[model samples]
Target: MATALVTGGAGYVGTHTCVALMEAGWEVAVLDSLENSSSAAIDAVAEVVGRGLRLYVGDCRDNSAVERALTEAGPDAVLHFAGLKSVPDSVADPVRYYRHNLESTSVLLEAMARHGVRRIAFSSSAAVYGLCKELPVSETAATRPANPYGWTKLISEQMISDVVRSDPRWSASLLRYFNPVGAHPSGIIGEDPEGAPANLMPYLLQVAVGRRAELPLYGTDYPTPDGTALRDYIHVMDLAEGHRAALEALVSSAGQVHTYNLGTGRASSVRQVVAALREATGHPLPCREFKRRAGDVAELWADPRKALLELGWSADRTLAEMCRDAWAWQSAHPQGYRR
Candidate 1:
């Protein structure tokens, strides 16, 4: 079995991907700072997979720590998911976002080069395509990131591409994912963002579980059927499977650098998501309409044909399933891994 190292293995996507890798007969190791995540997530993954994963609790920006993880884990490849990811927070502290995201990738790349780990699957974001004019954005679309967070991802992709170009042995799969929501069907592990949730599904779950007073539905004036923003919200399990497919492709394909968008290829509006969550939880969720925030896109989905054709992967979960699974985890753990 191939051994893989996951940088942020305890995070939302990271935990689910770890479960997928383990179930696929891959030996897994995790290196996480536990800053925005918790070690309990790793434990939950162990419970779901019926095995324990090797974990290195350290920041990815630290060269020594990364080197230690590389040396100890001895992974054949790496899945890089360690970075600050929040649009509003990134706007509040652009320097922190850029420095932390860039520095973590730089150090990890350096350690990988030193340790002879050439293959990597990076967690990229759809935010890289800022305010796309097209309905379903493709990989060839122009990348003009609006916020600092998106810029960091774009810059990281460039850095990874540069590395792949410089060396023939190096190969990378940059998986640009759309909105990743929901939880594992088992409800043992899921997205547990620290403090107030930044994404839609988690916030909706919180409101349903009574953690928050009401949902702040941003922007009721977008040019959509519901007069709200539309996004391609893919389930977390589907995204995890995409990671597995990307890792396999990276190991097998001859291409040095590959980019694929992992999404459902269908956009769901905020109103639709709210309605789904309300029905799923059987609660009349209260929502407050607000003006569209800056740097917010009106509509954005994915043309995931490339991923479907090349990676042999596509999101298969519906909006209702996403809400149901997310609520299962939220209702079970109202405090999100704390209780």
Candidate 2:
């Protein structure tokens, strides 16, 4: 019925969301650069859905590529998930992060406007909250990004919001995702981070699968009960379902921007996560605590009530489920998509 053009459809979140969208009865087309992602993820998506998705292997920042995808797909909406997403890497290379993240959104939004594709669900991050003032961060919390990565995401959110305001044709949802863990549950399609996995769940999965020696605890001296940094880790599939809900909402509304926090609204410390994974994977999941990382916070979760009350979506997967599903994919393909 409706076609959706997904940027970065081969990426960890994008791939899973593609499956969710397809299952929800949307014809999906992908435009990806495959910079840090693999084409095999798309193939896995096809396998999971039992159908082929048209893919444009190109960068979202390229106007020509964006136009080509928009013109050809004739999508009813665009799900933008293409960007460089690493905090340390962004700190090291602010210019690259700003250029890549900002340019891609600007270019894509311009192209979408040109083609009259007005509906978009953007993959924003919790990093936009920077150092949170409140315990359970809500969508209304103040945003003061501590690094370039977070700044880029915040700016992109504003850009989309501005577009929706400027043109009555555009309706948008900016989903500020917390830690997205777990796989598709099928173990067929999952997160496949390149080089070294940056986040917690993937790294733990690698450790369980024998890729890493141990899960290096980033900070264990925090003020939390477990003396470790805390996060709101949501399942990837639930995050996908959140996107589905947001997109469906946007389709029926116009001339507005809705921002939601896609998280479980509960914080889990690193020690707790490691213990859960140990039970799920049958690995000791040993860890060595390190000094607190710079810019590290004690805890940051979500006040996800707005999303539940508005979009009827909330993360339903538990920590054990996250570990189990993540281990399933990582164990099946230890080398990520390269396998």
Candidate 3:
């Protein structure tokens, strides 16, 4: 059986990807700090996949902890997802973003080098391609990050590329993600951001579930159809499957750093999202307008043809399904894992 050690596996994407990997017959071990995430997610993953998980509760930046996890898990590859992910938070505190995101990656690479784990699948972001001049951005677009968060992801991608280029034996997949939202269809595991939610989908879920009074609609005067910023939101489950596909490709192949944009090639406005969630929950989903925040672009989606061609992976979920599943999880676990 193939073994994989998932850093931040207790997180939203991490937990869902654990379900995908386990279902695909891979033994999964999780290393998490449980600082911005919860252990309950692991339990939910176990419930969904009908398998127990091996987890190490520690930050990824800790070299000893990572080394120990690597030694015990005996992974074929490492899925690096341990990083602070709030764009606004990163903008407000670039130092924290830089220290945590970069250092964690650096330490994980060092540990991987020590343990001879040559294959790595990095969790990257579309923020790296900031202020995209083109509508459907491809993988080859210029990476000029508008914010510290984007710079971190772009720089990390470069770091991974450099390492892989230095040693041709090292192989890695940098999956540059668009906005990942929604929950698993089982509704057992879903996104539960610590403190205030940053993304539009989570904020909508919170408002519908009474966690918040209303959504704070940012940037209502953009060039998009509805004036709000446009984003390419893919269902989290589809993204999990993409991760599985990427891992399988790595297993069958070798000696190259593969980068692919993981996103649905469709853009949705904030108002459209509000409408979809309203249908999902039968709530008014009130909203208040706010000025555009830093580190945000007017509109951008993905040219997902590369992923579809190479990995044979394309997101097939609709906006309605995304909202329905997300509402299912949030309504069932209103206080998140606390319930």
Q: Who is ahead in lDDT, 1 or 2?
A: 1
Screening candidate 3 with a backbone cut-off below 3 angstroms (N, C-alpha, C), the clashing residue pairs are none
- RMSD of candidate 3 to true structure, Å: 1.1
Give a tens-digit lDDT track for model 3, residues 1-339: 999999999999999999999999999999999997888899899999998999899988999999899999999999999998888788899999999999999999989988899899999999888888987999999888888898999889989889888887789999999999999988999999888887889888889888899888878999888899888999999999999999889875567989999999999998999999999999999999999986578889999999999999999999999999999999999889865
| Per-prediction backbone clash count | 0, 0, 0
Q: How well is each residue in 243-287 modelled by candidate 2, as lDDT tens digits?
A: 999999998889989999999998899989989988888998878
TM-score of 1: 0.98
C-alpha lDDT of residue 11 in model 3: 95
List the pairs of residues colliding in candidate 2: none
Provide the global lDDT of candidate 2 against the true structure: 0.92
Query: Which 10-residue window of candidate 1 scores lowest in summed lDDT?
Result: 248-257
**lDDT of prediction 3:** 0.92
lDDT of each: 0.92, 0.92, 0.92
Top candidate (lDDT): 1
Report lDDT (Cα) of residue 3, candidate 2.
Answer: 91
